[model samples]
Target: MPIPSRAALVEHLVRTRIAGDVATPRDNNLSHYRKLANGDRHYWLGLELGDRWTDEQDVLAVMAERCGVSDDPEHRAGQDTIDPELTVAALDRLAARLRKAAAGKERVLFATGHPGGLLDAHRRTADALRAAGCEIVAIPGGLIADEGMVFQVGGVAVLERGATLWHTHSPVPMAAILDGLARDGSPLPDLVVADHGWAGCAAQRGFDTVGYADSNDPALFIGEAEGTLQVTVPLDDHVFDPRFYEPMTDYLLDAAGLPV
Candidate 1:
């Protein structure tokens, strides 16, 4: 069975319910609202974009149209993209528009297709929302590079230096902590540290595979034989809170018990 797209689902919901005057394309410019038959205020997420290749807006518009809310413009109603760069541009534009619409709205949440990638994009989006005076909560990414390293190394003779190297050029895009086992030409990992995406982890898990979140948790440091390890690396809780970074020269110096 084929699953219906978001637009289809929203269109069905709108058509079955909602009875009110919908703003026309021009009136939908901004600050458009509809009073439902039950006196509920329903704001449209994509009211201005009558017909556009926006997944979120198209879904919201379809909902309005189905509920007799009016989409007389016959806007483009589906996702169509041949160019990856263009798609990313479109996404940025859509995010800007949605953030603008979120102004003065209570509890507006922006949903994205690529959440992990969205973490990378949060700086701009979060700033826009803050400027708009909207209450926004951008959840932290599930994992980071260093926390992932501790999880990968487990407890393989904690080097006094606490330095690790990542093999970024390998066929697989993963960070490799050079433990004694890796240097000793051992074929099997003490435990597979699946810090990459689900597919990436699945492919690398010829040995026991642990998910990224599972490995990063500080409570599960059972040891290499147990296929479990965890560590709490201090993270800066500024704008991008909980984002882990490699210990700086000063941090390393401090960790080495040397006065800066």
Candidate 2:
């Protein structure tokens, strides 16, 4: 079938809303909408902006930086990073739009993720939404970086030939390790590796499993879950942190059958 035109898209959205084909619209103006073929609805979506795209976009620059993807060859030599600035800016933009929706007494559900160490930012965003009278619910089932959050299994230490792997986590360093193994052709060592939570659990299934640890790594991934009014990240603590706000917004809008 031919892709729908802009006007056609709007018509589809209106029809879906009227037919109740879309999920219940929140009480926010300019609410992001999503419509699936199976007729399911979601409040948020994820975006994928590789290395170069992230650097070019101001909103994603900080997240990319936080992910350790920068121009500095040393940091970015092997892998790309998510810019923290970009992630926050994207959230700010979304929050602004959501605020407008809230003004009109509409329900707004924005979704995204932040670095593990940046819990404060997430809390601040939640506070802002509450101030606007928009309900906020974060998806659960992951480990936070520090204590008070669920501190699971321990750390891992791998020493091979001349390479020493210490305290690595999945979704973050795991990818890095895979990349390193691929690019550098490094061999795995026979040592004790400890991981906790989902990422570590997943890794343990494939590695020489060690037990739990303190401060495994500084990354986590939440799944494509909807809060009362937002969607959180979907990876483990730090599986794959891609700074993707624009893409996520575009996706949710598209999924809602709204015009970009």
Candidate 3:
């Protein structure tokens, strides 16, 4: 498929519900935001917060600025919003980073918690980067055991030819991967493209990272703000059909000077 022009892609972003008016309910976003403010580990997604974020209102302000969600504390319910412009702007930055990584032949890792929603895009990104001569690293063989949760084993970090990993959210998987790498004295990734806990944890580990986030997932935004994360594209993650992201993938690849 031919890549859409910027204007056309932006139009598709709103028309297909990839951006602009989002489907993430305000209440749901608020619920997560409140959890983040309260320092819930699940919502924090492995990010350590500073004292300034102790208040829910302060978190709201940050979300409002970064994710385009409503800042009104009075908003008790209804739909949430993500500015399409913000998504585009962030994608521009993401693409620039990808271009730099490709030029430098950086070893890259890509993972996603929202595998159902974003795997296609990430896969395409991986393919393009590989075609550009960048090495897509895979960190296989890890187990994640969250407290009070069932232990998940055989969660190997398989890197597809297109550069995507199986569904992953916990930093434990990456931590295990890094540990194995250190044990074998293998090189670590120069960049990580991921979302949710994967992105947060990698950033916390001081890896150059960029990823997507919904209005509710404030950890990546906070990480970006704190300089731990490189860039975060804010949008309604998991709200649209997977194919709706093709144009976006094309845009990013083209922006990176990779073949679309």
TM-score leader: 3
What local distance difference test score does each model get? Answer: 0.25, 0.27, 0.78
Tens digits of per-residue lDDT for model 3, 73-164? 99979977887888888999999999999999999888667767787788788888888999887554443333211221222133222333
Which 10-residue window in model 2 sums to the lowest lDDT?
220-229
Per-residue error at 116 for model 1, in Å?
6.6
Clashes of each: 5, 48, 0
User: Among all windows of ten consecutive residues in candidate 3, which has the lowest summed lDDT?
Assistant: 147-156
Q: Write the per-residue lDDT of candidate 1 for residues 91-176, one digit (tens) a residue.
A: 23333334333444322222221122222233333334445554443212222332332221211111111344331212112223
User: Could you estimate the TM-score for every candidate?
Assistant: 0.20, 0.24, 0.89
Error of 2 at 25 (Å): 42
Residue range 50-80, candidate 2, lDDT tens digits: 2322222332232223222333322322323
Instruction: TM-score for candidate 3, please give it.
Output: 0.89
Q: What is the lDDT of candidate 2?
A: 0.27
Write down the TM-score for model 2. Answer: 0.24
How high is the lDDT of residue 18 in model 3?
78
- 1 versus 2: better TM-score goes to: 2
Candidate 1 residues lying further than 4 Å off, grouped into runs, are 1-82, 110-117, 138-260
Runs of candidate 2 with Cα error greater than 4 angstroms are 1-92, 104-116, 137-260
